[model samples]
Target: MTLEISRLLELTTWRVFDVADDGRVLAGCDESGSVQLVELAEGGCTELTALAGAVVGRYLPGERAVVVQHDSDGDERGQLSLLRLDDRRSRPAPLSELEPLVRDSEHVHRLLDVLPGRIVYATNRRNGVDFDVVIRSVTTGEEHVVHDGGGMVAEVAISPDSRFAAITVPATKPLSDQVLVADTMPETGADQLRELTDRDLAARHLHPGWQPGGLVVTTDAGRDRTGVARLDPRTGGHHWLVTSDEHDLSGRLSPNGRTLLVLTAVDGAHRAALHEAATGEHVVDIALPSGGWCGYPLPEPVWSPDSRFAALSFSSPSTPGDVLLVDTATGTCTPLTSSAAQLAEETLVEPTVHRVPARDGEQIPCFRYAPAAPDGSAVLLIHGGPESQSVRSFHPLVQAMVSRGHTVLVPNVRGSTGYGKRWYSADDARNRLESVQDLADLHRWLPSVGLDPSRAALWGGSYGGYMVLAGLAFQPELWAAGVDVVGISSLVTFLENTAPYRRAHREREYGSLIADADFLREASPLNRASAIAAPLFVLHGANDPRVPLTEAEQIVEAVRANGVAYEFHVYPDEGHGLAKRANRLDAYPKALAFLSRHLG
Candidate 1:
């Protein structure tokens, strides 16, 4: 049963956004060849919004209307819209029923929390660089600015009484953040903002939610690994609620504040459990798929109003993304949505986790997917976000390559999360190339793991794409070919041309342009393009806000000057990555064909 690459690419994926009291679910699915919003009920899945790119949403208190955030093309400037729901009618409603809520095309807006009469969000409309957290009334459209202390606002939460708000903002260093609290009502003289955590510590705080006693957040401030803690708003002190030595811990509280859904990151996989919120007592460990992704994208484990049940999105190599319904009392997880499109789960390959030793005695964790019938070649797939980890998730490109008989190795180099704070900050600032050194070590160790060193190619997107180009340019003879999607060629040009809101945040990890210009130029692949002698394929979105299209154009021009074999493609409607299925179906197959010809 050999399936075509198109068939493998056709596999649909979904993400759960919110769950209603009556067991209805709000989700994002790619069944329409593009990511769109849909409502999951007993009758059937009904499309809610037909907007472009990807859409994320939540049920406004009553479940009669939903507040959705969507961006045009791939520009990343999100706009908020309200979709009026009438579940009584039965048939799917038209896309024209949406009402614009907060749409400012010049700036970015992100929805943080939704309540009965208002919604909390972070927007950079104030000055276009600093994000301000605002609570706006759903009926009157009145806005109340809570915290505007000048930094990228990550997460925000409203108190149970709707009087106080808590937010997480960047601290003095990279990968470190602090939580702040402020009154949501401007009429109250107590609206003055105050820090909720120690300002001198270098810890990263996230997932701020109000409990009866204090603010519940996950931080690694005074510890090596992240753990759940309760921060006292008045005293600026904290105490541990959930702590683990072997893994990073994060949790979300139920609406009633009685139960906490905690997720633990074990290497690249996840483990979930229910705990008593008051005493932090473990209730029951929920059984989950062996290798599946359950953490990330902010919203997961959306609980019902009564806190009896929760919905979480799960995905892995063999399973396409789907929402799972979890019962807290019995610890039962039932599938709520299916996007397999009639494909057999057994046909897909499952990866085996391994720890590859680096040259400096450091062990790098990776997932290897081996095809039943080998084509004598391999592809090293690198993940983006030197800050992000490559976990067990459904990747269309990885599956497509396996179906074509190519073994794939996905590694999490130093500076990737899910490990620990120490591991993630290893390659920061002056130590940038140390992460690239791990790539060289992996290339050398490939033969020991039943892979052909001479027939291997490099594949990645964004920062992963930068790794591909760096490997080819820095260690020219190691790879057969390289496929770079929206990769940075020159750190100097990247910092200069990237979106203003993202520049400072990215510079903290990749070194500053003003202080480390010479080092940045020397590390750029575009500086040594002549060193690349292998065939290459470069793909980028013309509207990419993070890494501009100039990145692709300059690299292509440099490689062309050296007479290197290469293919360059630019998607006018795409940004950082391919968000549309039609574009992915077209781009990935060509890239695979290029790898096939070069590897042969």
Candidate 2:
């Protein structure tokens, strides 16, 4: 049953970045890790552009061009390029050529919308610190700032008539707590910036976009669960578009602005539905055949220009990801690409969703993958972004371990999103240690599903990596081995050393180092590394900007001083995660070996 590493690496990974306005052409990353333009009718794929490292942004209005973001060595501070499909013989040009909106040092650039004669975008090029909304003419190359503010412009949307721009200004508070609807007049330079929504220090209002009458956003303003709501920019009136008690709802307006494509996440699973934009009447519920994660870049559901079909990216435990077309009328789905066809003969395990209760009576939703044969050993995989969820995605490492007879349990811990806002922010600041307790509760519940808690390993990246370190430091007896990947070890140092642009945002979630100094030290696993009883493996990218290399080095220093068995690795060319296939191939096997040596 030993599978070749090459076979696993060869699996075609696909990610749908954008569907053309006409929905005839789909743009996405292909097997070679390059963006390709696929024509739906003929099923012909043409290589659009290839770079050392690039992520396809979105297609322009008429599908004549696309925005590609490229970075070197995963630094994240990369340049944006416009890949013109019309110029088939020419290569992508740097976005600066069109207008000097993004400089070499100013790496954050986002395309907001494409108007009649201009393209609207958001960039930190104004001060290289805070984002500013800019409108650049397509023909003249003249640009004007629509909204310049002291805070980071998180989201931006240009109205269809190109008169107003709705921007989410997160500077009002630590988190994005306000929305500014402004008139984009070239003569005034956005002098009239009006507040569209009332500020709530506790609630997060995000994804501001324009509809026919007003602005629409995802907010938990008056409820625990985040839902889609329409806000009147003029009168500050609010109307609920979609609301749910058991699930969180967020969506996007169709190209014609007649329908709303609602994305719902219930217990870590995603479902899509089309609704009447004005009446909130559900039209058709699109069935997702792939039981996996969806909507990575917020509202990824793209409607066709005619609003007859919607295209989206989907991935499951067995499938990597593919662009799917869903008919609005009948809700029939058709796959536009087959990225996981290479694994057709391989046996993949389907994850079963289970709710395990924590000591405090909170239900932790976990995805369990059981092997065909019993090994009496298991691994608990934690997800990053304590705000993110662990959905049923195609995880090669999980499959590899399961293939060798190991059960894998991935939990959507309390702090994870896709749940209500209250549950998502449950682990803020001092309350984060409670999340570690949730991990212990998960270990205690393992035996109920025929798993041996004593023989279990803990594995995670980013925040999950922090959880791995926490599990070893706090609940030492629960895990046999642990793997930490690009995780925060010292909260205080991490807050001080992380990228400046991200400091305030991280402070909003993890608690500020200046204010919560004592709590940060108390929760940091590095300070309590002496309590670790299990063998540890630490993996990180040297270029990581979020957690930084020091986070891993400091913990390795502690483990070495404690005389604990441990392995440490740092990929020189990677950033947050092992994004490059070669790095993954090199790093994952070492992780599998470490788990095997300790847990088996």
The lDDT of model 1 is: 0.84
Model 1 lDDT per residue over 1-600, tens place: 455677767777778898888778888888778778888887778888776677789999875889988888899998888888876655533345677778999999999889887788999999999898888888899898888888788888888888888888877677777788887676766647888776556788987777888888888867888988888778867788899988998888887877888889987778889988888889999887657554653246688767888888887666778888788878898777765545654377778888999988899998888888877688989888888888777776787788777889989998889988989989888887888888888888888877789999999999999999999999998989999999999999999999988888888778899999999998999998989999999999998999999999999999999899999988898999998888988898899889989988
In angstroms, the error of model 1 at 230 is 1.2
Give the alpha carbon lDDT tens digit for every residue of 191-211 in model 2: 478877765546667767677
Score candidate 2 by TM-score against the native. Answer: 0.93
Q: For model 2, what is the error of residue 405's alpha carbon versus the real structure, in angstroms, after optimal superposition?
A: 1.5
TM-score, every prediction: 0.96, 0.93
Question: Candidate 1 — which residues are off by over 4 angstroms?
Answer: 88-95, 296-299
Which sections of candidate 2 miss by over 4 Å? 2-6, 33-43, 86-103, 171-177, 186-191, 290-293, 297-299, 305-308
Scored by CA lDDT, what does every candidate get? 0.84, 0.76
